[model samples]
Target: MDIGEGARPGLRERKKRETRIALSWAAIRLTVERGFDNVRVEDIAAEAGVSPRTFNNYFASKGEAVAARQLERARAIADELRARPASEPLWEAITNATMARFALGQDDHRGAEDERWAEGLRLMVGEPALQGEFMKTSAAVEAEFAAVIAERTGTDADTDLYPRLVASAVGSAMRVAIQHWLRAEAPGTMADLLRDAFAQLANGLPTP
Candidate 1:
């Protein structure tokens, strides 16, 4: 076989991915059943039928297992935004990319998954340790967004305040929209709520 062909992941990669997914699902279920604080890493490992060492190999902590999908989604959004047309406005690019990456459309699992994600958000918000990890992951995405903004706006990422500020504001708006959706029991489509939130951002807010 060719060297490049031999380097392909094949069956092993697929099995590893399945194992990670199993561990993530097990962690989420455990967290839901017995609060985040009460669930230990070893418990999640047992629930997933894996050893604690295997769990650590996949994730740094319990919070990582629970929130890894969200972080992956954010990175996807950032990558999409970075690939958008250079002429697109920063906000427009970010909003469109985020929706494309995260907005749940007409899928059957939309309702149930949204509820679970909302519950996870609530848990993270209330837990100091999880909240810190959540913020750290979010900040990484914000930095990626800032880099995209800086590139499109012809500004240096280190020196420009506008890009950084815009990135922070966009992340804040998204969090607010998510909280609002959870409060309303995730009514209607998540895509609709996200679009409405982006529209509000497009329309300048009045000074308090």
Candidate 2:
């Protein structure tokens, strides 16, 4: 569907997004209730109220389905960063966009639900098959951010590697910040932790 430039998401695109979200949540719920290994692709499709073929159309594999939500969220962050004003620093823009998208909310599922999703993510980290898919998605996000940064800095994304490098570094730092917050039993709020993390990045890290 048309989603770029002046194009708006059409009815089909909106339906696809809803279906994808439903499938992703269903897969996570099933995996949380039963071990990831115990849940079959067909079972997840059924849980999501879609046929197995429809599930494949949305996600290539079960693991991908499980990770769909995070990947979609990351893509949204990239889009937001690309739309930020050119006068803003690349890092600041990206950090703001990322935090705005993922920052904790009062109604957000950060208790048992979050823990379950985190466990699923932890499992994917060790799964060899899913590693490639994860890397591809992460690289796509980096490229999107890099292109935006390149434009703002008046440099070509191809010749200048700084934008790409910075994007990767920032993405890694954000991932680490989230992991740390999660490990801390997700105490306080995601917004607070994210603000602290992004503030450090925006202010520049001090050398030892």
Candidate 3:
């Protein structure tokens, strides 16, 4: 349900979001343990303690279920950005909104000492089934982000380039930061990588 900007979620909205998140986590965990190809939608539904019919009501496929958190986080970021004070710099608002939504837009819910989840995430990432859904989700997120940017900056998302470009760049930067953290086994906090990525972007990405 679409609440007014800055409005608190009612109980029903909260419960629905929780269910979506639960299903998403279930899909991700099962994929991590058994690989994407092996995990069926029924398995994810069972893991999430919901019926397959209920899972179908929320998502179309196992891949969509796994990527559900991405949509949630992106929507959260858009709302966060909308709530920022007008006095705040656009880049700073973007950074803070992104931070509020997810740590570097990665699943940073794991403990700092826990590395197994990262490994699992890396392994699950290569599944062909998940990639297409993930890509589509990312595009949807970028378009939503661009619309929010246009609203904030008084630009036309459909015709003007600035909103779309900035949204895409921010999305790309977050993706790169998350990918680097996963692929390189980077020891730094995902927050640090995200901050550096935004800093470079805000600084016009001056050459080293």
Candidate 4:
């Protein structure tokens, strides 16, 4: 039997991915329900139906587990950006890539999972204990974005300032947009906010 190049994961890999997803959601839910400091690794493990050791194998701390979804989304965004056609302008590619990963259109409807993730992210951001872990995850993902930027620009990530600068600016714009969305009473979809944010970047933030 010839396994195709794009074959699905084996049983072990599938089980591992399930466990990680379970733990990630469990951690987010527990941290939001019971304050971050109060949600222990064991609590997350129990919620996910896994052992504490399994939790440890997947994540270092409750904070890391809680931030897993954000990390996953960041990676997905990078992957989408990387796959965009080379002829597209960089900023347009970034904006479209973000929208694609989010599955967002002008009249997009959010599901329960999307609402839960938004609330969980808001709560995590407000928790001081999780800030460190969140920043670490953000930094790691920023590096990934920088690498992709370098690839597209044909520059060395370590030596080129342009890629790093663009990555930082874009990342900061997204973070600010998210924080603003979380604070708004009638915030629109994340996709819209992100599009507006990247639009500002593409326009060089000309005076309003």
Candidate 5:
């Protein structure tokens, strides 16, 4: 369901999106509860209150379905970054836009949603089979951010190296922050870590 430029999505498109989200959530929940290999496509479809055929239409494999939730979120971040004020400095805009996606300055309460995300991350990190799907989603988001950077800087993402280079650098910073946060026993909030990481980049990574 591709809406035209500057056009809002219609009811049909909205319903399709809702169904896809529901299916992705259902897949994640079932896999986390029963292990990825134990859960079948039919089980996921049933959990989502959809048919196997419908599930097939939305995702080719259980791994793809499970990864779709994060992919959707990554795309939303790209959209947020694209919507930032054109006058804002590129680094500031990207940092603010990315941070806006999460609840900043809030306590790390382990809600059901948080558990789902944590479980999915664990699965991605621990399971060798799911790593490829996870990396694919990351690569897609990297390309998305590159395109947004290209647009903001008036460069061609396909032809210009600058936009892609900056985007990749930002992505690496974000990945490292996330990994550090995950490994820390009493780590600071992800928001703070992300802010610090981006600040380092924005300031040219001054010497210690």
Candidate 6:
């Protein structure tokens, strides 16, 4: 099978992915329930029905485990952006790729109702280790975005300014949209917020 369509992961690789996801979510939920400092690696492993050693094999720290899901989500978005048709506009491709991830039923990021979830997220904002891991994830994914955008625009990511600027702008836009959505009293769906954000981006943020 080629590297794309039919390249299914083997059983071991699939199992590893499952284990990693389980550990990641377990870390997040446990941390949210107990706060970051209270949630230990042992707790996360037990929650995921895996051994602590297995957790260690997958992640060096609880912060890394907790940040893994967000990293994976961003990675998926980057991959989707890279796969868009060559004819599609860059901003359009980015909007579509992000929307694909935040589609209703797949994930609902609107604030309210789930106070515990919101509180945990707020706590994560204050967590140095978690924030550091997330920033690292963002930088890595932004690099991925820069490379893909460069390819699409026929620019060099290393030496050209356009790719990095666009990548940074889009990344910041998404961050702002998500944070606002999470913090608002009755924030609307992520789709609406994302559309507005990307619209501003595509339109050069003209005065409202």
Cα-based TM-score, every candidate? 0.76, 0.79, 0.89, 0.85, 0.83, 0.88
Ranking by lDDT: 3, 6, 4, 5, 1, 2
**Worst lDDT 10-window in candidate 5:** 104-113
Residue 87 alpha-carbon offset, candidate 2, angstroms: 2.7
What are the runs in model 5 whose C-alpha is more than 4 Å off?
1-9, 104-120
**Which residue segments of model 3 deviate by more than 4 Å?**
1-10, 103-112
| Model 1 lDDT tens row, 58-157 | 9999988876655556667777888888888766787788777775423412434666755764665576767767777778767877887787888877
Candidate 4 lDDT, 1-208, residue by residue in tens = 3575345457668788778878988987787667687888999999999899999999988878987776777788899989999999999999988889778332223423366656765777888887888788888878888999899999988998989888888889878977887777677777888989999888999899
Best by TM-score: 3
Query: Could you report the Cα RMSD, in angstroms, for every candidate shown?
Result: 3.8, 4.2, 3.9, 3.6, 4.2, 3.2
lDDT of 5 by residue, 1-208 (tens): 4556435557668888889988988887777667788889999999999999999999999898887876676677788889999999999998888787766313322322365556555564567777788788788777888998999999999999989888888778877877776656666678888899899999999997
Choose 4 or 6, whichever is better by TM-score. 6
Pairs with backbone N, CA or C atoms under 3 Å apart (clashes), candidate 6 = none
lDDT of 2 by residue, 104-137 (tens): 3233336435666666555545557656766776
Q: Which order, best to worst by TM-score?
A: 3, 6, 4, 5, 2, 1
lDDT tens readout by residue for model 3, 65-164: 8887778788889999999998888889999998877755444546345677777788877777688998998999899899999999999999999999
lDDT at 106, model 2: 30
Quote the lDDT for 203 in model 1: 74
Backbone clashes in model 3, listed as residue pairs: none
* lDDT head-to-head 1 vs 2, winner: 1
lDDT of 6 at 177: 77
